[model samples]
Target: MSTAAAELRSQRFAAAVPDLERIEAMPLLAEIDALKRARNAVVLAHNYQAPAIYHGVADFTGDSLALAQQAARSEADVIVVAGVQFMAETAKLLNPTRMVLISSLAAGCSLAESISAADVRALRRRHPGVPVVSYVNTSAAVKAESDICCTSANALRIVESLGVPKVIFLPDRYLGHHVQQ
Candidate 1:
Protein backbone atom coordinates (compact mmCIF):
# COMPACT_ATOMS: atom_id res chain seq x y z
CA MET A 1 0.00 0.00 0.00
CA SER A 2 1.09 3.60 -0.55
CA THR A 3 2.25 5.54 2.51
CA ALA A 4 -0.77 7.82 2.33
CA ALA A 5 -3.18 4.92 2.07
CA ALA A 6 -1.52 3.16 4.98
CA GLU A 7 -1.77 6.30 7.04
CA LEU A 8 -5.41 6.71 6.12
CA ARG A 9 -6.13 3.10 7.07
CA SER A 10 -4.39 3.51 10.40
CA GLN A 11 -6.41 6.68 11.03
CA ARG A 12 -9.68 4.96 10.20
CA PHE A 13 -8.96 2.05 12.53
CA ALA A 14 -7.90 4.45 15.24
CA ALA A 15 -11.10 6.44 14.89
CA ALA A 16 -13.41 3.40 14.93
CA VAL A 17 -11.61 0.93 17.16
CA PRO A 18 -8.54 2.26 18.91
CA ASP A 19 -7.21 -1.17 19.85
CA LEU A 20 -7.42 -2.64 16.33
CA GLU A 21 -4.03 -3.23 14.76
CA ARG A 22 -3.62 -1.54 11.37
CA ILE A 23 -1.39 -4.34 10.09
CA GLU A 24 -4.08 -6.93 10.80
CA ALA A 25 -6.51 -5.14 8.48
CA MET A 26 -4.55 -4.42 5.28
CA PRO A 27 -4.90 -7.83 3.66
CA LEU A 28 -8.64 -8.05 4.35
CA LEU A 29 -9.27 -4.57 3.05
CA ALA A 30 -7.32 -5.31 -0.11
CA GLU A 31 -9.33 -8.47 -0.69
CA ILE A 32 -12.62 -6.65 -0.10
CA ASP A 33 -11.71 -3.82 -2.46
CA ALA A 34 -10.66 -6.28 -5.13
CA LEU A 35 -13.91 -8.23 -4.68
CA LYS A 36 -15.99 -5.06 -5.01
CA ARG A 37 -14.28 -4.15 -8.27
CA ALA A 38 -14.51 -7.70 -9.64
CA ARG A 39 -18.23 -7.89 -8.88
CA ASN A 40 -19.02 -4.32 -9.92
CA ALA A 41 -20.41 -3.78 -6.44
CA VAL A 42 -20.78 -0.83 -4.15
CA VAL A 43 -20.47 -1.32 -0.40
CA LEU A 44 -22.98 0.62 1.66
CA ALA A 45 -22.10 0.69 5.33
CA HIS A 46 -24.03 2.01 8.29
CA ASN A 47 -22.48 4.51 10.70
CA TYR A 48 -22.24 1.85 13.41
CA GLN A 49 -20.24 -0.57 11.27
CA ALA A 50 -16.55 -1.19 11.92
CA PRO A 51 -14.43 1.73 10.82
CA ALA A 52 -12.32 -0.41 8.53
CA ILE A 53 -15.43 -1.39 6.57
CA TYR A 54 -17.08 2.01 6.85
CA HIS A 55 -14.15 4.20 5.87
CA GLY A 56 -11.83 1.84 4.06
CA VAL A 57 -13.95 -0.44 1.85
CA ALA A 58 -17.36 1.18 1.75
CA ASP A 59 -18.28 3.29 -1.29
CA PHE A 60 -20.93 4.96 0.84
CA THR A 61 -21.40 5.10 4.62
CA GLY A 62 -23.97 6.86 6.72
CA ASP A 63 -27.04 6.34 8.88
CA SER A 64 -29.90 4.02 7.84
CA LEU A 65 -31.86 6.42 5.63
CA ALA A 66 -28.75 7.73 3.94
CA LEU A 67 -27.53 4.22 3.22
CA ALA A 68 -30.97 3.20 1.91
CA GLN A 69 -31.15 6.27 -0.31
CA GLN A 70 -27.66 5.61 -1.59
CA ALA A 71 -28.50 1.97 -2.29
CA ALA A 72 -31.60 3.03 -4.20
CA ARG A 73 -29.59 5.50 -6.27
CA SER A 74 -26.58 3.26 -7.00
CA GLU A 75 -26.16 1.96 -10.55
CA ALA A 76 -23.96 -0.96 -9.48
CA ASP A 77 -25.14 -4.42 -10.45
CA VAL A 78 -24.26 -5.71 -6.99
CA ILE A 79 -24.63 -4.04 -3.61
CA VAL A 80 -22.87 -5.17 -0.45
CA VAL A 81 -24.36 -3.97 2.79
CA ALA A 82 -21.87 -4.00 5.66
CA GLY A 83 -24.30 -3.68 8.48
CA VAL A 84 -27.07 -5.80 10.02
CA GLN A 85 -29.63 -7.98 8.25
CA PHE A 86 -32.32 -5.32 8.18
CA MET A 87 -30.03 -2.99 6.33
CA ALA A 88 -29.35 -5.56 3.66
CA GLU A 89 -33.07 -6.21 3.30
CA THR A 90 -33.73 -2.49 2.99
CA ALA A 91 -31.20 -2.26 0.19
CA LYS A 92 -32.85 -5.18 -1.57
CA LEU A 93 -36.27 -3.61 -1.08
CA LEU A 94 -35.12 -0.42 -2.73
CA ASN A 95 -32.97 -1.98 -5.45
CA PRO A 96 -35.15 -4.89 -6.48
CA THR A 97 -33.14 -5.55 -9.60
CA ARG A 98 -29.72 -5.32 -7.96
CA MET A 99 -27.96 -8.17 -6.20
CA VAL A 100 -27.87 -7.11 -2.55
CA LEU A 101 -25.75 -9.05 -0.09
CA ILE A 102 -25.02 -8.63 3.57
CA SER A 103 -21.50 -8.89 4.96
CA SER A 104 -22.77 -11.47 7.44
CA LEU A 105 -26.06 -13.31 7.32
CA ALA A 106 -26.09 -13.80 11.08
CA ALA A 107 -25.77 -10.14 11.85
CA GLY A 108 -28.92 -8.68 13.43
CA CYS A 109 -30.09 -5.81 15.59
CA SER A 110 -32.27 -5.32 18.69
CA LEU A 111 -34.58 -2.90 16.96
CA ALA A 112 -35.11 -5.28 14.06
CA GLU A 113 -35.90 -8.19 16.36
CA SER A 114 -38.30 -6.27 18.55
CA ILE A 115 -41.19 -6.52 16.10
CA SER A 116 -42.64 -8.74 13.41
CA ALA A 117 -45.24 -8.69 10.68
CA ALA A 118 -47.65 -10.56 12.89
CA ASP A 119 -47.16 -7.90 15.52
CA VAL A 120 -47.77 -5.25 12.89
CA ARG A 121 -50.87 -7.08 11.74
CA ALA A 122 -52.14 -7.13 15.29
CA LEU A 123 -51.54 -3.41 15.49
CA ARG A 124 -53.58 -2.97 12.34
CA ARG A 125 -56.34 -5.09 13.83
CA ARG A 126 -56.39 -2.96 16.94
CA HIS A 127 -56.22 0.36 15.17
CA PRO A 128 -58.50 -0.38 12.22
CA GLY A 129 -58.05 2.37 9.53
CA VAL A 130 -54.90 3.86 11.00
CA PRO A 131 -51.90 3.97 8.67
CA VAL A 132 -48.69 2.25 9.67
CA VAL A 133 -45.44 4.15 9.30
CA SER A 134 -42.60 1.73 9.76
CA TYR A 135 -39.13 2.80 10.66
CA VAL A 136 -36.46 1.67 8.23
CA ASN A 137 -34.77 -0.30 11.01
CA THR A 138 -37.46 -2.98 10.67
CA SER A 139 -37.35 -6.18 8.65
CA ALA A 140 -38.44 -6.41 5.01
CA ALA A 141 -41.63 -8.20 6.01
CA VAL A 142 -42.52 -5.46 8.45
CA LYS A 143 -41.69 -2.82 5.90
CA ALA A 144 -43.85 -4.59 3.36
CA GLU A 145 -46.73 -4.40 5.83
CA SER A 146 -46.27 -0.66 6.30
CA ASP A 147 -48.21 2.02 4.50
CA ILE A 148 -44.90 3.87 4.20
CA CYS A 149 -41.33 3.90 5.47
CA CYS A 150 -39.69 6.51 7.64
CA THR A 151 -36.27 7.11 9.10
CA SER A 152 -35.60 8.59 12.49
CA ALA A 153 -34.77 11.89 10.81
CA ASN A 154 -38.07 11.94 8.96
CA ALA A 155 -40.44 9.98 11.20
CA LEU A 156 -42.41 12.99 12.29
CA ARG A 157 -42.69 14.30 8.79
CA ILE A 158 -43.85 10.92 7.52
CA VAL A 159 -46.44 10.64 10.25
CA GLU A 160 -47.72 14.10 9.51
CA SER A 161 -47.61 13.55 5.78
CA LEU A 162 -50.19 10.79 6.15
CA GLY A 163 -52.68 13.51 6.96
CA VAL A 164 -54.12 11.43 9.74
CA PRO A 165 -54.67 11.93 13.46
CA LYS A 166 -52.58 8.85 14.32
CA VAL A 167 -50.17 6.48 12.65
CA ILE A 168 -48.74 3.20 13.90
CA PHE A 169 -44.98 3.60 14.19
CA LEU A 170 -43.15 0.41 14.81
CA PRO A 171 -39.98 -1.36 16.11
CA ASP A 172 -38.04 1.61 17.44
CA ARG A 173 -39.28 2.87 20.78
CA TYR A 174 -36.79 5.71 21.02
CA LEU A 175 -37.52 7.02 17.55
CA GLY A 176 -41.25 6.53 18.05
CA HIS A 177 -41.09 8.51 21.27
CA HIS A 178 -39.13 11.23 19.57
CA VAL A 179 -41.60 11.37 16.72
CA GLN A 180 -44.53 11.45 19.13
CA GLN A 181 -42.94 14.31 21.02
Candidate 2:
Protein backbone atom coordinates (compact mmCIF):
# COMPACT_ATOMS: atom_id res chain seq x y z
CA MET A 1 0.00 0.00 0.00
CA SER A 2 1.10 3.57 -0.68
CA THR A 3 1.92 5.75 2.32
CA ALA A 4 -1.16 7.85 1.67
CA ALA A 5 -3.39 4.80 1.37
CA ALA A 6 -1.95 3.28 4.53
CA GLU A 7 -2.51 6.54 6.37
CA LEU A 8 -6.07 6.72 5.16
CA ARG A 9 -6.71 3.12 6.22
CA SER A 10 -5.26 3.81 9.64
CA GLN A 11 -7.46 6.86 10.00
CA ARG A 12 -10.53 4.86 9.07
CA PHE A 13 -9.70 2.09 11.55
CA ALA A 14 -9.00 4.62 14.23
CA ALA A 15 -12.31 6.32 13.64
CA ALA A 16 -14.25 3.06 13.63
CA VAL A 17 -12.69 1.24 16.56
CA PRO A 18 -11.18 1.97 19.97
CA ASP A 19 -7.41 2.43 20.13
CA LEU A 20 -6.83 -0.88 21.94
CA GLU A 21 -9.02 -2.83 19.58
CA ARG A 22 -7.39 -1.22 16.58
CA ILE A 23 -3.97 -2.11 17.97
CA GLU A 24 -5.07 -5.72 18.44
CA ALA A 25 -6.52 -5.86 14.95
CA MET A 26 -3.49 -4.38 13.19
CA PRO A 27 -1.69 -7.69 12.68
CA LEU A 28 -4.79 -9.42 11.27
CA LEU A 29 -5.51 -6.39 9.06
CA ALA A 30 -1.97 -6.45 7.71
CA GLU A 31 -2.28 -10.17 7.00
CA ILE A 32 -5.55 -9.62 5.18
CA ASP A 33 -4.06 -6.83 3.08
CA ALA A 34 -1.06 -9.01 2.22
CA LEU A 35 -3.31 -11.91 1.24
CA LYS A 36 -5.44 -9.58 -0.88
CA ARG A 37 -2.36 -8.44 -2.79
CA ALA A 38 -1.03 -11.98 -3.23
CA ARG A 39 -4.38 -13.34 -4.42
CA ASN A 40 -5.57 -10.39 -6.53
CA ALA A 41 -8.68 -10.07 -4.39
CA VAL A 42 -11.06 -7.32 -3.34
CA VAL A 43 -13.11 -7.32 -0.14
CA LEU A 44 -16.64 -6.02 -0.41
CA ALA A 45 -18.30 -5.34 2.92
CA HIS A 46 -21.97 -4.65 3.53
CA ASN A 47 -23.34 -1.84 5.68
CA TYR A 48 -24.01 -4.28 8.53
CA GLN A 49 -20.43 -5.59 8.76
CA ALA A 50 -18.27 -5.17 11.83
CA PRO A 51 -16.29 -1.94 11.96
CA ALA A 52 -12.99 -3.87 12.03
CA ILE A 53 -13.73 -5.75 8.82
CA TYR A 54 -15.41 -2.78 7.12
CA HIS A 55 -12.76 -0.20 7.98
CA GLY A 56 -9.70 -2.42 8.16
CA VAL A 57 -9.96 -4.92 5.31
CA ALA A 58 -12.77 -3.91 2.98
CA ASP A 59 -11.63 -2.59 -0.37
CA PHE A 60 -15.17 -1.37 -0.98
CA THR A 61 -18.10 -1.00 1.40
CA GLY A 62 -21.76 -0.26 0.85
CA ASP A 63 -25.32 -1.61 0.84
CA SER A 64 -26.21 -4.80 -1.10
CA LEU A 65 -27.03 -2.91 -4.32
CA ALA A 66 -23.83 -0.91 -4.17
CA LEU A 67 -21.84 -4.07 -3.38
CA ALA A 68 -23.38 -5.84 -6.38
CA GLN A 69 -22.56 -2.85 -8.56
CA GLN A 70 -18.98 -2.90 -7.33
CA ALA A 71 -18.75 -6.66 -7.85
CA ALA A 72 -19.90 -6.25 -11.46
CA ARG A 73 -17.32 -3.55 -12.05
CA SER A 74 -14.45 -5.32 -10.25
CA GLU A 75 -11.59 -6.81 -12.25
CA ALA A 76 -10.17 -8.76 -9.32
CA ASP A 77 -9.66 -12.50 -9.73
CA VAL A 78 -11.26 -13.17 -6.35
CA ILE A 79 -14.11 -11.38 -4.60
CA VAL A 80 -14.53 -11.66 -0.82
CA VAL A 81 -17.79 -10.56 0.71
CA ALA A 82 -17.76 -9.71 4.41
CA GLY A 83 -21.50 -9.93 4.55
CA VAL A 84 -24.41 -12.35 4.47
CA GLN A 85 -24.82 -15.28 2.06
CA PHE A 86 -27.33 -13.38 -0.10
CA MET A 87 -24.88 -10.55 -0.69
CA ALA A 88 -22.16 -13.03 -1.62
CA GLU A 89 -24.61 -14.77 -3.93
CA THR A 90 -25.49 -11.44 -5.52
CA ALA A 91 -21.80 -10.77 -6.13
CA LYS A 92 -21.40 -14.18 -7.77
CA LEU A 93 -24.48 -13.53 -9.91
CA LEU A 94 -23.05 -10.21 -11.03
CA ASN A 95 -19.62 -11.68 -11.67
CA PRO A 96 -20.14 -15.24 -12.74
CA THR A 97 -16.61 -15.51 -14.13
CA ARG A 98 -14.96 -14.42 -10.92
CA MET A 99 -14.46 -16.51 -7.77
CA VAL A 100 -16.69 -15.16 -5.04
CA LEU A 101 -16.42 -16.13 -1.37
CA ILE A 102 -18.17 -15.32 1.89
CA SER A 103 -16.65 -15.31 5.38
CA SER A 104 -19.05 -17.84 6.84
CA LEU A 105 -21.48 -20.49 5.67
CA ALA A 106 -23.79 -19.61 8.56
CA ALA A 107 -24.02 -15.95 7.68
CA GLY A 108 -27.60 -15.94 6.43
CA CYS A 109 -30.64 -13.71 6.32
CA SER A 110 -33.92 -14.64 8.00
CA LEU A 111 -35.90 -12.62 5.47
CA ALA A 112 -34.29 -14.49 2.59
CA GLU A 113 -34.99 -17.78 4.36
CA SER A 114 -38.63 -16.92 4.86
CA ILE A 115 -39.36 -17.48 1.17
CA SER A 116 -38.06 -19.86 -1.47
CA ALA A 117 -38.16 -20.32 -5.23
CA ALA A 118 -41.14 -22.61 -4.71
CA ASP A 119 -42.89 -19.85 -2.78
CA VAL A 120 -42.26 -17.45 -5.66
CA ARG A 121 -43.67 -19.98 -8.13
CA ALA A 122 -46.72 -20.42 -5.91
CA LEU A 123 -47.18 -16.64 -5.78
CA ARG A 124 -46.97 -16.53 -9.58
CA ARG A 125 -49.61 -19.24 -9.81
CA ARG A 126 -51.89 -17.36 -7.42
CA HIS A 127 -51.41 -13.93 -9.00
CA PRO A 128 -51.26 -15.03 -12.66
CA GLY A 129 -50.05 -12.06 -14.77
CA VAL A 130 -48.89 -9.93 -11.86
CA PRO A 131 -45.15 -9.28 -12.03
CA VAL A 132 -42.80 -10.63 -9.37
CA VAL A 133 -40.55 -8.01 -7.81
CA SER A 134 -38.02 -9.68 -5.54
CA TYR A 135 -36.03 -7.85 -2.91
CA VAL A 136 -32.26 -8.12 -3.31
CA ASN A 137 -32.16 -9.93 0.02
CA THR A 138 -33.64 -13.04 -1.61
CA SER A 139 -31.55 -16.00 -2.70
CA ALA A 140 -30.34 -16.37 -6.28
CA ALA A 141 -33.02 -19.00 -6.97
CA VAL A 142 -35.78 -16.67 -5.86
CA LYS A 143 -34.30 -13.86 -7.93
CA ALA A 144 -34.19 -16.12 -10.98
CA GLU A 145 -37.87 -16.85 -10.47
CA SER A 146 -38.75 -13.16 -10.27
CA ASP A 147 -39.26 -10.75 -13.14
CA ILE A 148 -36.94 -8.20 -11.50
CA CYS A 149 -34.87 -7.69 -8.38
CA CYS A 150 -34.56 -4.59 -6.20
CA THR A 151 -32.86 -3.37 -3.06
CA SER A 152 -34.58 -1.56 -0.22
CA ALA A 153 -33.15 1.69 -1.51
CA ASN A 154 -34.65 1.14 -4.96
CA ALA A 155 -37.74 -1.01 -4.21
CA LEU A 156 -40.23 1.79 -4.79
CA ARG A 157 -38.50 2.94 -7.96
CA ILE A 158 -38.06 -0.62 -9.25
CA VAL A 159 -41.70 -1.44 -8.58
CA GLU A 160 -42.76 1.73 -10.36
CA SER A 161 -40.32 1.10 -13.17
CA LEU A 162 -42.18 -2.13 -13.96
CA GLY A 163 -45.08 0.04 -15.21
CA VAL A 164 -47.48 -2.42 -13.59
CA PRO A 165 -50.43 -1.49 -11.37
CA LYS A 166 -49.91 -4.55 -9.16
CA VAL A 167 -46.78 -6.58 -8.34
CA ILE A 168 -45.69 -9.19 -5.79
CA PHE A 169 -42.90 -8.02 -3.47
CA LEU A 170 -41.11 -10.93 -1.90
CA PRO A 171 -39.93 -12.06 1.58
CA ASP A 172 -39.73 -8.93 3.71
CA ARG A 173 -43.18 -7.73 4.60
CA TYR A 174 -41.71 -4.66 6.34
CA LEU A 175 -39.87 -3.56 3.22
CA GLY A 176 -42.90 -4.35 1.10
CA HIS A 177 -45.03 -2.27 3.45
CA HIS A 178 -42.51 0.57 3.22
CA VAL A 179 -42.67 0.38 -0.56
CA GLN A 180 -46.46 0.36 -0.47
CA GLN A 181 -46.58 3.40 1.81
Candidate 3:
Protein backbone atom coordinates (compact mmCIF):
# COMPACT_ATOMS: atom_id res chain seq x y z
CA MET A 1 0.00 0.00 0.00
CA SER A 2 1.09 3.56 -0.56
CA THR A 3 2.06 5.71 2.40
CA ALA A 4 -1.09 7.86 2.05
CA ALA A 5 -3.41 4.82 1.74
CA ALA A 6 -1.79 3.13 4.74
CA GLU A 7 -2.20 6.28 6.76
CA LEU A 8 -5.85 6.50 5.74
CA ARG A 9 -6.46 2.91 6.79
CA SER A 10 -4.81 3.58 10.15
CA GLN A 11 -6.94 6.65 10.61
CA ARG A 12 -10.10 4.67 9.87
CA PHE A 13 -9.12 1.94 12.31
CA ALA A 14 -8.27 4.49 14.95
CA ALA A 15 -11.62 6.20 14.48
CA ALA A 16 -13.49 2.89 14.68
CA VAL A 17 -11.65 1.51 17.71
CA PRO A 18 -11.33 2.64 21.30
CA ASP A 19 -7.90 4.00 22.29
CA LEU A 20 -7.14 0.89 24.36
CA GLU A 21 -8.08 -1.56 21.58
CA ARG A 22 -6.41 0.34 18.74
CA ILE A 23 -2.93 -0.89 19.59
CA GLU A 24 -4.11 -4.49 19.85
CA ALA A 25 -5.92 -4.35 16.52
CA MET A 26 -3.11 -2.74 14.51
CA PRO A 27 -1.12 -5.90 13.80
CA LEU A 28 -4.20 -7.89 12.79
CA LEU A 29 -5.36 -5.05 10.57
CA ALA A 30 -1.93 -4.85 8.96
CA GLU A 31 -1.99 -8.58 8.30
CA ILE A 32 -5.43 -8.29 6.72
CA ASP A 33 -4.23 -5.43 4.51
CA ALA A 34 -1.29 -7.46 3.35
CA LEU A 35 -3.47 -10.46 2.57
CA LYS A 36 -5.95 -8.29 0.70
CA ARG A 37 -3.18 -6.85 -1.43
CA ALA A 38 -1.61 -10.24 -2.05
CA ARG A 39 -4.87 -11.82 -3.14
CA ASN A 40 -6.39 -8.79 -4.86
CA ALA A 41 -9.39 -9.27 -2.58
CA VAL A 42 -12.17 -6.98 -1.49
CA VAL A 43 -13.91 -7.23 1.87
CA LEU A 44 -17.62 -6.69 2.06
CA ALA A 45 -19.10 -6.10 5.48
CA HIS A 46 -22.76 -6.23 6.50
CA ASN A 47 -24.46 -3.50 8.46
CA TYR A 48 -24.43 -5.67 11.59
CA GLN A 49 -20.65 -6.20 11.55
CA ALA A 50 -18.40 -4.69 14.22
CA PRO A 51 -17.13 -1.22 13.48
CA ALA A 52 -13.59 -2.52 13.09
CA ILE A 53 -14.62 -4.84 10.28
CA TYR A 54 -17.13 -2.40 8.81
CA HIS A 55 -14.93 0.67 8.73
CA GLY A 56 -11.43 -0.63 9.21
CA VAL A 57 -10.74 -3.23 6.50
CA ALA A 58 -13.96 -3.43 4.52
CA ASP A 59 -13.71 -2.06 1.00
CA PHE A 60 -17.48 -1.91 0.90
CA THR A 61 -20.12 -2.18 3.63
CA GLY A 62 -23.87 -2.21 3.53
CA ASP A 63 -26.95 -4.33 4.04
CA SER A 64 -27.29 -7.76 2.40
CA LEU A 65 -28.89 -6.43 -0.79
CA ALA A 66 -26.34 -3.71 -1.24
CA LEU A 67 -23.50 -6.12 -0.57
CA ALA A 68 -24.92 -8.50 -3.13
CA GLN A 69 -25.01 -5.68 -5.65
CA GLN A 70 -21.43 -4.79 -4.81
CA ALA A 71 -20.37 -8.39 -5.20
CA ALA A 72 -21.99 -8.50 -8.62
CA ARG A 73 -20.12 -5.41 -9.69
CA SER A 74 -16.77 -6.21 -8.08
CA GLU A 75 -13.76 -6.74 -10.31
CA ALA A 76 -11.69 -8.21 -7.44
CA ASP A 77 -10.24 -11.66 -7.81
CA VAL A 78 -11.44 -12.64 -4.35
CA ILE A 79 -14.33 -11.55 -2.16
CA VAL A 80 -14.34 -11.85 1.62
CA VAL A 81 -17.76 -11.45 3.17
CA ALA A 82 -17.99 -10.38 6.79
CA GLY A 83 -21.56 -11.60 7.09
CA VAL A 84 -23.67 -14.74 7.30
CA GLN A 85 -23.29 -17.79 5.05
CA PHE A 86 -26.20 -16.83 2.82
CA MET A 87 -24.67 -13.45 2.15
CA ALA A 88 -21.45 -15.10 1.07
CA GLU A 89 -23.43 -17.52 -1.03
CA THR A 90 -25.21 -14.64 -2.69
CA ALA A 91 -21.89 -13.02 -3.44
CA LYS A 92 -20.67 -16.24 -5.02
CA LEU A 93 -23.84 -16.58 -7.04
CA LEU A 94 -23.47 -13.07 -8.30
CA ASN A 95 -19.79 -13.46 -9.06
CA PRO A 96 -19.36 -17.08 -10.13
CA THR A 97 -15.85 -16.48 -11.41
CA ARG A 98 -14.53 -14.94 -8.20
CA MET A 99 -13.25 -16.73 -5.12
CA VAL A 100 -15.69 -16.02 -2.29
CA LEU A 101 -14.76 -16.54 1.35
CA ILE A 102 -16.60 -16.11 4.63
CA SER A 103 -14.95 -14.66 7.71
CA SER A 104 -16.16 -17.55 9.90
CA LEU A 105 -17.52 -21.00 9.18
CA ALA A 106 -19.55 -20.88 12.38
CA ALA A 107 -21.46 -17.81 11.28
CA GLY A 108 -25.08 -18.70 10.45
CA CYS A 109 -28.53 -17.29 10.15
CA SER A 110 -31.72 -18.61 11.68
CA LEU A 111 -33.83 -17.17 8.92
CA ALA A 112 -31.79 -18.77 6.15
CA GLU A 113 -31.77 -22.08 8.01
CA SER A 114 -35.53 -22.03 8.47
CA ILE A 115 -36.18 -23.45 4.99
CA SER A 116 -34.46 -25.74 2.55
CA ALA A 117 -34.47 -26.38 -1.20
CA ALA A 118 -36.48 -29.52 -0.60
CA ASP A 119 -39.05 -27.51 1.30
CA VAL A 120 -39.25 -25.10 -1.62
CA ARG A 121 -39.73 -27.97 -4.08
CA ALA A 122 -42.55 -29.31 -1.92
CA LEU A 123 -44.11 -25.88 -1.74
CA ARG A 124 -43.92 -25.72 -5.50
CA ARG A 125 -45.61 -29.11 -5.78
CA ARG A 126 -48.32 -28.09 -3.31
CA HIS A 127 -48.98 -24.77 -4.98
CA PRO A 128 -48.48 -25.44 -8.63
CA GLY A 129 -48.29 -22.42 -10.95
CA VAL A 130 -47.63 -20.08 -8.03
CA PRO A 131 -44.37 -18.25 -8.53
CA VAL A 132 -41.88 -18.57 -5.68
CA VAL A 133 -40.25 -15.32 -4.65
CA SER A 134 -37.50 -16.22 -2.25
CA TYR A 135 -35.92 -13.77 0.12
CA VAL A 136 -32.23 -13.16 -0.53
CA ASN A 137 -31.62 -14.59 2.95
CA THR A 138 -32.14 -18.11 1.53
CA SER A 139 -29.30 -20.45 0.61
CA ALA A 140 -28.06 -20.67 -2.98
CA ALA A 141 -29.86 -24.00 -3.45
CA VAL A 142 -33.13 -22.49 -2.33
CA LYS A 143 -32.53 -19.52 -4.57
CA ALA A 144 -31.91 -21.82 -7.51
CA GLU A 145 -35.25 -23.49 -6.84
CA SER A 146 -37.00 -20.17 -6.55
CA ASP A 147 -38.60 -18.48 -9.54
CA ILE A 148 -36.99 -15.23 -8.46
CA CYS A 149 -35.12 -13.73 -5.54
CA CYS A 150 -36.02 -10.51 -3.76
CA THR A 151 -34.57 -8.64 -0.83
CA SER A 152 -36.74 -7.32 2.00
CA ALA A 153 -36.48 -3.82 0.57
CA ASN A 154 -37.77 -4.95 -2.84
CA ALA A 155 -39.94 -7.94 -1.97
CA LEU A 156 -43.20 -6.16 -2.63
CA ARG A 157 -41.94 -4.56 -5.79
CA ILE A 158 -40.50 -7.80 -7.12
CA VAL A 159 -43.71 -9.66 -6.36
CA GLU A 160 -45.72 -6.96 -8.00
CA SER A 161 -43.33 -6.90 -10.92
CA LEU A 162 -44.05 -10.54 -11.55
CA GLY A 163 -47.66 -9.53 -12.16
CA VAL A 164 -48.74 -12.56 -10.27
CA PRO A 165 -51.68 -12.66 -7.95
CA LYS A 166 -50.02 -14.96 -5.44
CA VAL A 167 -46.35 -15.60 -4.69
CA ILE A 168 -44.62 -17.77 -2.14
CA PHE A 169 -42.15 -15.81 -0.04
CA LEU A 170 -39.73 -17.94 1.81
CA PRO A 171 -37.67 -18.10 5.08
CA ASP A 172 -38.76 -14.86 6.72
CA ARG A 173 -42.44 -14.98 7.55
CA TYR A 174 -42.33 -11.48 9.02
CA LEU A 175 -40.86 -10.05 5.84
CA GLY A 176 -43.40 -12.00 3.83
CA HIS A 177 -46.14 -10.52 5.98
CA HIS A 178 -44.70 -7.07 5.54
CA VAL A 179 -44.64 -7.56 1.77
CA GLN A 180 -48.20 -8.79 1.81
CA GLN A 181 -49.28 -5.74 3.78
Q: Best by TM-score, which number? A: 3
Q: Which one is best on lDDT?
A: 2
User: Which 10-residue window of candidate 3 scores lowest in summed lDDT?
Assistant: 1-10
Candidate 1 residue pairs that clash: none
Model 3 reaches what TM-score against the true structure?
0.91
lDDT of 1 by residue, 20-118 (tens): 555677788788777877888888888888666776777778887888889989989999998999989988988898899998989999888999999
Once superposed on the true structure, which residue ranges of model 3 sit more than 4 Å away at CA? Answer: 1-9
Q: List the residue pairs that clash in candidate 2.
A: none
TM-score of 1: 0.85
Residue 162, model 2: Cα distance from true site in angstroms: 2.9
Candidate 3 residue-wise lDDT, 72-157, digit = tens: 98989999999999999999988988899999988889989999999999999999999999988889999999999887777889
Residue 34 lDDT, candidate 1, scale 0-100 = 79
Candidate 1 displacement at residue 51 in angstroms: 2.5
lDDT of 2 by residue, 22-135 (tens): 999889888998999999999999989889988888888898888999999999999999889999999999889999999988999898899999999999999999999999
Model 2: lDDT of residue 13: 82
